[model samples]
Target: MIKLPKILKYPNFSRLYYAGLTSELGSFVTETALMLLVFKLSEGDKSKLGIIRASFLFFLTMGSLLGGPIGEKFNRRNVLIFANIIRIPIITVLFFSKDFYSILLVNAMVAFFTGIYNPSRQAMINDIVPQKEISIANSLFGSTMAILHMVGPFIGALVFSKMQGIDEILTFDLITYFLGIALISTINYRPPKKESVDNVQTSLFYDLKEGLRYAQKREDLRALLFNCSIAGFCIGVLIPLLLPFVTEVLHLSDREYGLMLSVFGLGGFFGGIISHRLTSKHRPGKLIVSSIAFEPLLMLLWLLIPVFIPNLIIFFFWGVIVFIRIPSQLNYVSETVETEYLSRIHSILDLSFVVPNISGGIIIAFIGNSFTTMEMLFCTAILFVILIFFKMFTSSSKALFKSEAKRVTRDQSIQDGIA
Candidate 1:
């Protein structure tokens, strides 16, 4: 077994972790509150909710596109700080918005900053942690996100229910952003100076083109991105369906539904722990492919089995297996790709995940009554299974996997030699 280094021992990583924790915790509350606010403002009109969400998502995708260049071309820490600072007032104004359109405008602005924030924050992780320790860093970060997802909604709901207004919660979220900025500003990181030969000036579009070319040249990286994109789409489709399945299909109460999410979070927490230990032991290519393949099978099983206890168990592992591979995926990128392209690749990957997310609503709307939700789930799961198998066995994928295994071996040998 490969031993993992302690991530918290690094002061900068610790600060980033705490900042992320606070930020995500606040996000959970903010997201829940925003949804409630939208529902209230629209008088329970579901179509309006969709419009609001789509507006935010549209700008978020745009933000991510711009984030790549902004993150790579500037000081990442300052970029992150600016991102947070910009969000504070935007969210603050959300509380005072008189109409849904005003709220939508604010949401768009916040999301644009978010696109900038996420890539810069990710780049910061790649910057502060050494390649060997990147997996641990990502593991810790991924775990925090999982934990937030588990209880953040419940907490957000609770606050919204009790306070009877979005203002307090919005203020709280603003404070967390403030805290994130403060904590992040304290990290002692000096950005690396740009290195170039022949002094060629490159436009942002040029950088984006070059990044795409770089990803295209590496079979392994392309395979990883393609597989992740498919998996992300599946996740997007399934996520919104979970609540409906729990409430309607299982006939479970809200409290029970919350517990189920908590259990999933617990599974993710443990998975993060397990991932830290296994990250060094496994080959990245195999780990990523196997985990991606495993999830759809679980989703299919979820549709087949209707019993609550069995479904609960499945959800637990669903969280575990899915979260476990994320750190490994990020670690693979960190180790295999050169540092110069980290921000660009991260932004590209981020866009891949978000772009598919919008399709989930379409999937839900399309299959709403044609088949039962569970049946739809089964069909989607099967679709993912077919896609994964086909992709894995394809000529390009096979070559990618083979070359990736060799690269992992070479990288490990170098790390061991250094140790």
Candidate 2:
């Protein structure tokens, strides 16, 4: 029910939002098809699937690290447009390749471009929306992604079922990327005079170092990064394990599993709507903390729930908590950092997720195929507790909220005076 505010009524932001939606929906299709193709080609070996998934994450991390400098050195919109344009060739190659290694290589390339695209796109959004409206804007964006996740796969499935070819799905994804690029190309992005080239360091290594150093020196950012890293590590364990758990332990079919994922996406959509409304009136830090605190507990309860029911209600709650928390964290990062440094900030923050994603898979793999569901749940709980306790000790939420409010108010007052 939450509506986008007047601040987001600008045509540029609207174009960006639509572009994001189209691209995300395309990603959903590509991801679903890729996973299916991998499983089929590998004879249902979960390890291969994990490798495919991990490779994409690895490339994404590399891209994130590289993107920071590029974002600062060039116009962000140009970078985004270039990345999207590059995707056409990459995806075109994917349409022909069915080999495991080739598919993995192509997928990694796609993810690499995505990494470049994401930070620049996000930085652009930060530039477009008002300081106070950042959180709500992010929530709306999250909502769009959630809805796409919910519907995109179903549409993919329908298309794939009819066409019965990876080429068809790849073509669909490629077209969406082109659509996104066209939409983004129409936007007018004027970098603020204050954020011009003189303000940004020219050296890539020095710029990268500055970004890392800035994150380290900023109290709220440092805490946010640490807490989010722990959270990502925990979630990384759950993500690959979910489908297996549902199929192997709960004995759910592919169709049923897909439905469960859709339900989770729906939960995310609802959560995003709620977050969009609340962020305009309340501090994002509080909402983030509450959501993070609740996720582990709900996940733990989900583990305890008897698997008798055909539908998994607990998964819905888990999805809701996770989705709600994301926008709050994103809002904090996007709003607190300077526009010129926004991409670097995002890259650094994303490292929290990337490191864990790559390492978590290997750790889980080594822990053996025999690791029980309950054991995994316990590990997740422990990590969650550690993160929550650290946040409490640092009182990060309170500090960030107060500081952000003061910064925004000051910016607004200055703008008003100038106006």
Candidate 3:
């Protein structure tokens, strides 16, 4: 038998890690294929692509409104399984979709279940991993995602380039989804003793309110939520804009664009390894704020440089900074939240990002083909500035960035708890 890593030695988390890894890769590949399908079905309307993406975000947000309650009310593992199982039929329908709206609607439905899956899985991480290993666990997850984002698109593009029909990609997605469920079934999870099963609230609305209230009560969480939203908005805006920016302004080919993504992923994987080492010495909050402060500047620098080689360098460096920041952020949240409130707070955090992500897509979609590529590029540039300035300057942001800076890592916190 293969010897597991220290953190993966936890039986439940180990299964969850593999299950989530495969599921995430499947999602990325399918997402790439689905986008191509929608673009083709819509007869190459670029705006519709943005619309499809935005609709997914909107519906995902809607689903998350209830995911928190359900996760808190039901067994979390069951919720994760249900999230995957429910999507099989929906994805099956995508293979038959002929119209743009049908494609959009089906994918958006997948997003709803995914919205639930995201938070429950996030919340569950703290439960299964040993506190000292939280940083490494999160690094593994983030690194895998970065790798998928790097490669999944290319695989999807290649598969679709050879497409006999949409069914092939959707069929693959369903198989992976089923595999995710099966892996989840083999893993065993035990909720902490304090999380009484009988204590579930009858009212999901009230349960949600309680979560919102919990965030409002804390200075740091409120700040973190704000940061999550802005970061999401940056992502949202970039999604619709980046391709155009590369092709039109930078005069790079699709191949170069793919290369940029791959390099970034490669850098992120290394950065995650570095971060795994850093957690032993530094606080997660400090890692996060440092990443946040440097990112927009790096983005600004990349935009200014504009050469293909330098842009690749910037993308790679940015990815490294990002992967470093993510694990630290995850470690921070894991150490901070109480057991009972963890799932709900995570859901609220998901909404924090997803809602703004929707808005960003809508903004780009609304811009339409009316503006020249330069004008949209100009608009995107403005977003970068705002993203930079806000994170660096805001007062509550200062408190938020510093909030966990003085605190100990999860390992230390766990030690303190035992004492």
Candidate 4:
């Protein structure tokens, strides 16, 4: 008999979790389909891939800027539903988009609405799950995301190879959004107690201002947002580099490429489990900094040893570090941020990531072709190291590490006394 994760025992959370699984799977599928479609349409112009991704993510960033305010000011459930509904036409337009520019435009539109959906959904976790279970909840969400990220793209690619048409793929994506809407509708949420008629009456602009102010007032959040920007840039650089590295450097086929992602996803799945189990034992911030700091070092090492099997092992470890970082970061935020500002703060975090993510795409687009994949990857490693060094110096990180140090010292003192 299987025992469910404790977080999943909550009825509302279970429903929302399953709903997220469906929507997230569709989202990854759509992303893969769009990438393939644009690649073919542009005659394998790798630069265009960067352009499409950057544009898609740019609008997502912009939309997120507004999404936080909108989600907080209006009914969150309604916000998610409306975002899903409006996205239908956007995905439909992809069927008609033939040129690179048109495809980019349609994808950007889709990203914007999807962006709106993300913050609301992230913040919604608080409404459905108990406060004590937040870490487990985040870990579960992270694991689902890792699994879907691998499986969804693999499914999309398999279908595309067989059908050899973007239209069918687009239709599949559209259907999923409808399913997402249906699932979202079924979720019953408990609105925040801080939400009152008076507070709700405030203008979206006012809420937006307050959200920014809230983040501005907090040093820890400011550091986290800054860290996000650095991660964003590294992520931007990594995305365009991965396929080329696997295929060109490793001299492997598409199947090998998929296997690489599968291995990473497997690592991420276990990482989430490890993170969830450790929630009771370690500080979230300690887990976050420890996991995140070591990740880039693995990236640096991966570049040094380029054989396929060894690199597969490396990718797995990288994935574990990532999953550890993700849940710990989310848990940290949940503990600190007020429920009222949760959506907006998440939106800000998204923007911090996406803005540099767009820049990363552009870097790969222009600077990438000039260098070999290995060389470009080395540059990525350098950026990641820089990001980590930045993390070590942040005030929040110091405090987190300090707290862990004190705990260890106290534990040792008690053992000495017993002896």
Q: Score each candidate by Cα lDDT.
A: 0.74, 0.73, 0.75, 0.76
Q: Residues 300-384, candidate 3, lDDT per residue (tens digit)?
A: 7877787888988998898888888778778777777776777788889889988998988887688756776556555665776
**Candidate 1 deviant stretches above 4 angstroms:** 1-5, 36-54, 98-103, 163-165, 362-376, 399-419
Candidate 2: residue 279 lDDT (0-100): 77
Local accuracy of candidate 1 as per-residue lDDT tens digits, 269-288: 87777777777677656667
lDDT score for residue 375 of model 4:
83
Clashing pairs in 4: none
Per-residue lDDT of 1-419 in model 4, one digit per residue for the tens? 99977666666677678767877777777777667666667665667777877888899988898898887867788888898899888778767666777788888988898788888888877656666567778999988877876687677667766777778767777787788788778766545555476544777667777888987876666666677788788878777667667767888654566667777877888888888887788877778768768877998998999999998899888888888878877887777777778888888888888999999898778876677878877888888898778778878667654433211101111110100
Q: Residue 91, candidate 1: how far off, in angstroms?
A: 1.1
User: Per-residue CA lDDT of candidate 2, range 228-278, in tens?
Assistant: 777777766766666566666777654555566677788888989888887
In order of appearance, the predictions have TM-scores of 0.87, 0.88, 0.89, 0.90
- Which candidate should be chosen as best, given lDDT against the real structure? 4
**Candidate 3: where are CA atoms >4 Å away?**
1-4, 41-44, 194-202, 250-255, 404-419
Runs off by more than 4 Å, candidate 4: 1-3, 195-202, 402-419
lDDT of 4: 0.76
